[model samples]
Structures are given as C-alpha cells and as structure tokens.
Target: MKSSVDQIRERFDNDVERFSNLETGQSATIDAPLCLELVAEAAAAATPEARALLDIGCGAGNYTLKLLEQFKQADATLIDLSRPMLDRAVKRVSAATAGRVEAIQADIRGAELDEQRFDVAVAAAVLHHLRSDEQWSTVFAKVFASLKPGGSFWVADLVAHQHPGVQSAMWHRYGCYLADLRDAAYRDAVFSYVEKEDSPVPVMTIVDHLRAAGFVGIEILHKHNCFAALGAVRPITGG
Candidate 1:
C-alpha cells in the first residue's frame, strides 16, 4: 500500500466526488489578493507581456485556473506529481484562455525547469508536503532558478507557529473551521493523517531560504491563523 503522501495524490484525483466536504474547495485566504498584486507587478516589468506562468504542485488546478483568468494571454506550465490532477487541470484550463497550457506530471524539485523560463510562479498549500527543512530549501532554490529576472514567486500555505500558546490557538481555529461538519472521528482522522505526512515550518524559515536562493524584496502577503501567503522576487540582475 502507498504511504499517506502517495495516497493523498490518489485521493486528490478522486476529489471531484469529495470536494463538497473537503478543504480543497475553500476560497483563497484574505492575503491572497496581495498575491495578485505581486503577479501584476511581475507582469508590468516583463519585456513583452507576462505570458509564462509556472504553477508548482498544482493539485486539481484551482490556482492555475485563477492565473489563466488573470493573464488571458499568458501560457502556463503546471507541475504536479499526480497524473489525474494534471489531466483535470488540462480539462479545466484549456477552454478558459487562448494561451498555451501544458502539464508536467513530475516532482517540481527535480523537474527540468529552464532558467529564466517563467514570469511568475505560484504554489498553494504545497510546500508543507516536503519532509524536511532541507528539502524545502532545495525546492525554493529550484523555483528561484526557474524564474526570469524580476519574476516573482507567490506561495500560500500553512505554517508552524513558533510559540506553543499561539500554536494551540491556531490549531483551535483550524479545528473550528471543520467543526461545523460535526463528525469528530472524521476530523480526527484528517488531522492524524496530516500529522503523519505534513512537515510544516515557520514562514520565517522560508523567508531565509528564499533569500539564500536569491529572492529579494520578500514580503508576507497575509496570515490567518496558521495559513498565510508569501511573495518573493528574483532580482532583475543576477546570473
């Protein structure tokens, strides 16, 4: 049997039937609008137009759908580990824009993404899947190398709180968000799965890693409980 991380992809592939009750369908967080601002900033700085966007861990393609809408002329190269999610992404994004859309069903960390290849990169609720801080840093560098100068990387994810009392408060809110379902066992199972598979870290660590990877002008776009969005830019002049 596959481990939880492997199984999670299969579950996402089956998400169409389960999305009604899952967190996957939730709207973007309050700080998400700031991500759009960063995207627009990248667009304005690009030579021709902001026409090449990359989406990492694009589960079921929700984030890509938003990018397609925002840049109708931009093409997308979406990377994910699950083939089912990639297929679904293609179907959802194909008709929405005239720009080219391609899916690479591979792990983004080892994928062959060319340097200066994209104008903007987006990742949502994805980095927590990496098993360690080292792996997280590697993925950050991979993304940093994949962007063009002046390109920006936008990420939305859950992070670990540095303080224990604050951590409890954040978990309490996360639990409350699911409390309406009123299925204690179901909620417990979900969190148990998360505890076993997810390796979330403080957003500050990510900021440091992005800086080491050559991202400048970094900012935290928003924070709500444990969930937040962050934006970082690859400077316009660098090798």
Candidate 2:
C-alpha cells in the first residue's frame, strides 16, 4: 500500500519533465549558481579537493550539475524519492563525475545511507515536503551520520514564518511574487499546492534540528523573504 509520503513522491515524479528546466525553480534562493556562491562565501576557505558530497532530494539534477561544475573531481551521491527524478540526476552527473556519482531513489524520511562518506551534504528546496518536524530531524540525523566528522552540510529551502503577522506578510508577498512571475491563476494554484503538500518550518527550527543532529558552527548563509540557505559542520571531534 502506498503511504502518504509515497503520494507526495509520486506528485513530484509527475513533474519530472519540467523538473530539469531551471526557470521553473526560480524563487528567492533557487538560482543554481547563486546557491553555490553562497556556499563558497560561507566556507571562505576552500573545501578539500575531490571530496564527496551527498545531495538529498536532488530532484532533476539542478544542484548536482552546478556542484560538479564548480568543484572539479568532487564525487557525489544523489538521493531522491522519485526514480524518474533520480534518473534525470544520474544522467546529468554521470559524465561530469566519471563514475564518481551514485544515484539512489529513496525517501529521506526513512532512507538509510550506505558505506559512502561525504565531506558535505546539501538539499535544495526539498525539505518542505517532509510531513513533520520528526521527519526533518530524522533527515538531519541521517545526514550527520553520512558525513565524515568535520564534514559540511547545507540546505536551501522555503521557510515558514512563525509570527502571525510575519507569516501573513510572507504569504502575501510570495503570492505577489508568483503572480508577477507567472499569472494570477498560476499563483493561486501554486499557493494551494504549497498549503496542501508542504510543511515548511522557520529557519531557526532547522538550525535547532541540525544542532540536535550534532552539527556545530551553524551558519545562516542566506535568507530572502521566506527562502533561506543554512549550513553547518559536523564536529571533527564528534561533539
């Protein structure tokens, strides 16, 4: 029997054809190169060369392609709930990494990673689909375990505003942004889809989950209205 999570995964799978188009993903922080630029700025010092990366909810290969482009020889493991999405990501990264890339079709909520180790783990615009905070915490813990000690982790996603006024403002602004980008009917449909299928938390709550998962030196790399990019490292001493 299909679970609720499965239904959400299926919906994302249905969008696979349009998923690869970068423009469809535009938002406050969805720009492909801009996201890595934020990561580079946050890192300041360069990360180790040829290091491995774990990409959670990779979708149709947007972030993976950019990461490989920026970090030559970096290996990547891409995980997503939808196989169709994973297939696209696999083809996208296979040539770039030359056998260094692995793609897995698995849901983050319960998926267990293998012997692969990663220097950094990142997810883009993906976590809001998780049904609850518990699932989010689980994803963090799993990513923490997957990384080598002292490894980095980052995420770019939509965040829910906590205060009533702030939430109202963000929602209205996002609606306006969508309307400007697309049409009014499209904006309304997008809003409805978000309300029904997504569960976004405030940015601090994400940091709290990362801390609970044993990450240190947490950084809020970027936030624009309701979208944000946050990153941190697992303690080398395994704190």
Candidate 3:
C-alpha cells in the first residue's frame, strides 16, 4: 500500500499541467487576479512598517508568484510539505522575482515556522488536506502566532456544503468535466487520487476553527460553488 503522500505526489507528477489547470478553474484560481489584488489591498491596509508575507501551503508557488508580482517590495516565505512542490515553486519564484522569495518544506501542522513573523499570512487550496479538527486548530493557531499584531491571514480552499451528497455530486461532475479535457491516463489518476477513503474537513468547519483560534473579523472574500476564499485579522493586542 502506498502512503497517501506518495500517492498524491505520483498523481501530481503524472499530470502537473492538467492538475494545475483543473485547480486554476476553481474559484481560488479564477479569483487569482482578484486575490492578488486583495493581498495588495491587505498589505496596504496594514501599517506601513509591516512588509513581510508568509504563504502557507504554497504549492507550486502559484499565489506566491502572483504576490511578488503584485507587491514587488514585500518579501515572501513559501511553506509546503512536498519537497518537489517547493522546488517547482522556488523555480517559478526565481524566474518571476529573480530570487526574492524564500521556500520552506515542512508540515504546517506542527513544524516550527522559524522565529520569522509576517505582516500577512496566506493559505490557498489548503486546510481541507488536514485530517482532523484538532489539526485544523493547530495550523490556525500557528498561523495566528506567526503574525504580528493587526496582521491579516488570507485562506482559500474548497468550502464544505451542508449536504455531503450534493458536494460529492458537484465534485464528481467537475472532476469528470475537467478530466475530459485532459488525457485519459491523467484523468484516471486524478479521479483515483480524489476518491480516497478518508475525506478531509469541510470549509465552514475550518472557518469556525479559525475563529476558535482567536482570529477576528472572519469573512469569505470570494466563492465559486464549493471553492472559496476566507480571511481574518489577528487581534492587535494578543500574542
């Protein structure tokens, strides 16, 4: 039996472009230009003294590259669990920003995020991958602690619906629709990978978890069916 991580990597490696394109179709991807715009907006909203940005679960540096493009002055840290994903992101960042971004490979659940703090933290297409409510809480708490007072955390991923059956139907439809556009082998790999036994957490629960972790002013900035972007601000007084 292959480990879940290995299986995921194999699927990704087999059809990176197809997978990227499928992901790009999501609200998070469709809202990429807008999201980057919002990040700039958030960065501007922060005190002028704050300039660093941390991108949690920065797979393939999609958002990381956009952030650098949108805000040339701000430095960014790209964190993810997959080394190959991080490597790709590093290359993308280097090509786009001439080596202005940093990359770190570690699980966001318990890894020490270094002493470095950021003015803003962004997690796109993540959160759902976490296996438990406690894991979600732990990651959010880490994000909260990694930020400066009044800093912002922007999170984007697939939101959970009230009806699991409806959600499953939508995912199946979308996945099949996308797979049709790609090669058969690639499509099978993606479908097989997604149809795993243990599903990840839903999006609404993640928002609740974030609030439980002490974030304030939580709101969904964008939504496209199950895909959405959410954000909250760290309290100005708390550690």
Backbone Cα, N, C clashes tallied per candidate: 0, 0, 1
Per-model TM-score versus the true fold = 0.85, 0.89, 0.78
For residues 1-239, could you state the per-residue lDDT of candidate 1 as single tens digits? Answer: 22465676766667543322122344323244454454444434443356888989877666766666657768888788888778877777776667899999887666888878898888877788887667877888888888988888888887889988988998877776555455667567667766766677888887888888889888776777777777788898974
Once fitted onto the true fold, the runs of candidate 2 whose alpha carbons sit more than 4 angstroms away are: 1-3, 22-33, 40-46
- Candidate 1: segments with Cα more than 4 A from true spot: 1-5, 16-24, 27-48, 181-186
Query: What is candidate 3's TM-score against the reference?
Result: 0.78
lDDT to native, each model: 0.72, 0.76, 0.67
Tell me which of candidates 1 and 3 scores higher on lDDT. Answer: 1
Worst 10 residues of 2 by lDDT: 23-32
Name every residue pair that clashes in candidate 1: none
For model 3, give the 10-residue run with minimal summed lDDT: 19-28
Prediction RMSDs, each to the true structure: 3.6, 2.7, 3.8
Error of 1 at 92 (Å): 0.9
